[model samples]
Target: MALITRGFGGRRRDDPNLPPGQYRTDDFPVLSAGPTPRISLDDWELAVVTESGERSTWSWAEFTALPADEPTVDIHCVTHWSKFGTRWRGVSLDTLLADVETAAEYVVAHSYGGYTTNIPLEDLLDGQAWVAYEFDGEPLVPAHGGPARLLVPHLYFWKSAKWLRALELRLDDEPGFWETAGYHNYGDPWREQRYQAD
Candidate 1:
């Protein structure tokens, strides 16, 4: 795993497709609030747990050694900018799921910054989702979610949890941090489920 760092800042680049500004949560087309979740764990929490409770942990080197594939796909942010032809690398979600035993109907993804998002098991198990370690053919920078991030291309970018830590299989659809706050439960980007349509 890449060493965790703070003070990572983002720069705005002129993308003909997006408005000119420092892109951030405020720039988000949809905004809402919710209670952030927290967890206290030791280094032993570093293991990946399969549905059947099989556990496997990886060091920085081992995690990076997993087979990687590049995906060139358009990325749509809930903040309203769509970056096209973005490339990412990491193990395919399907490949990772195959190693686990699960009867789950949903998934609750946990992140480092006490953020969580609930996604249907079907969505996560789909071949398109990935545990992305690289972006644009390079190791993903921290601000953009380095080490590993969850990529759910079909949903708004917030659904793509960054600084991912664990995947908790659930038997029910539990709203995550944003969902509980006001973001749509199923953030379908095409449907414009960016915020609660009040």
Candidate 2:
């Protein structure tokens, strides 16, 4: 499968954050399903759309200008590698959506190049998720979802869609590109939800 690229990072087996069937990697890896989209800051904008089609927008400057939080968390990829102690700086998804209201129970995170992923709206709240722009104190790189990306570390990395643009709230769950193709709908790393049994 084009999506499965495994790298063993020689991490300790005792690390509790390392999910089952995962190895620790100190170095970040670059994996993408499509060509890297170069979104100039001038043209970059993040939109939030409710199930009823209500939309709220945040431009590049406006997004970065918000009060930022630095989250230290571990990142796990479905490919079997996990990065521990990964630090990021960005506005919490809660902070971004504070002024917006939605009755939706789920979310479809859409990105450039038509990449999308499904995430539970509840999983994104209460400081669990962020629209991260900087990683390790550097502006995110395109290959690694630079400029901006959704950070949902509780799930597989793919759910944290790269090159993120809009988040569409939904009352029902729908599979995104990878999920529909083969990956699990709700990717919990600890449970090893890489693919649902066929």
Candidate 3:
């Protein structure tokens, strides 16, 4: 098990009143991209390529059998509205990173529906990030990025890329779906990179 720091700041359970379930700021615009995309994966279809170009693919059953742990964390979106104390379950990113060797400096997290996000490899291997397959003690729902999702608590929620499918380690920085459309390349929540600035 990887040791993670308890808190880093953003949202807290004691914060002002907010409804349960995931909540984002008006700035995010509800992502009107229509219904969520689905990409089925059997045990043989799951793959992970390390920055060093090593590859490991797992079947659905194999992945599901891996050790999973629950973590309660706060989520902050670049748009606004911090959600606190959300529970998630999945293997820690550190565990996954340990299995692969990477010399890349960054990662492009790809998803179905062509959505993707660029994140630094250092941020992902730092041990706080996770591949969350469950939320609130239950299997994640489709609208909320079911099956699996990336959770990077420190950065803006966009960096948490939902409907997560693959992690492509890159030797250099590359903008992703939203980043290409004017979102900030780094997307720090405290910096508030909700939209493109003049």
* Candidate 2: residue 147 lDDT (0-100): 90
Clashes in candidate 1: how many? 1
lDDT of 3 by residue, 1-198 (tens): 987765533353334433233353433234424578665654224456766677776566777788877888777765456667778998777877676766788889887667889988888876678888888778876677767888998777788877777888879998998888988888666555666682
Candidate 2: which stretches are off by over 4 Å? 1-12
Candidate with top TM-score is 2
Candidates ranked, most accurate by lDDT first: 2, 3, 1
Q: Which candidate ranks first by lDDT, i.e. highest?
A: 2
Ranking by TM-score: 2, 3, 1
Per-prediction TM-score to the true structure, in the order listed: 0.73, 0.92, 0.78
lDDT of each: 0.69, 0.91, 0.72
TM-score, cand. 3 vs. native: 0.78
Relative to the true structure, candidate 1 reaches a TM of 0.73
Backbone clashes counted, model 2: 1
C-alpha RMSD for every candidate: 10.7, 5.5, 9.5
Model 2: lDDT to the true structure: 0.91
Q: Model 3 residue 25 lDDT? A: 43
> In candidate 2, residue 92 scores what lDDT?
95
Tens-digit lDDT string for candidate 1 (158-195): 88887678787766778998899888898876666777
Report the lDDT tens digits of candidate 2 across residue range 88-125.
99889899888887888999999988999999899999
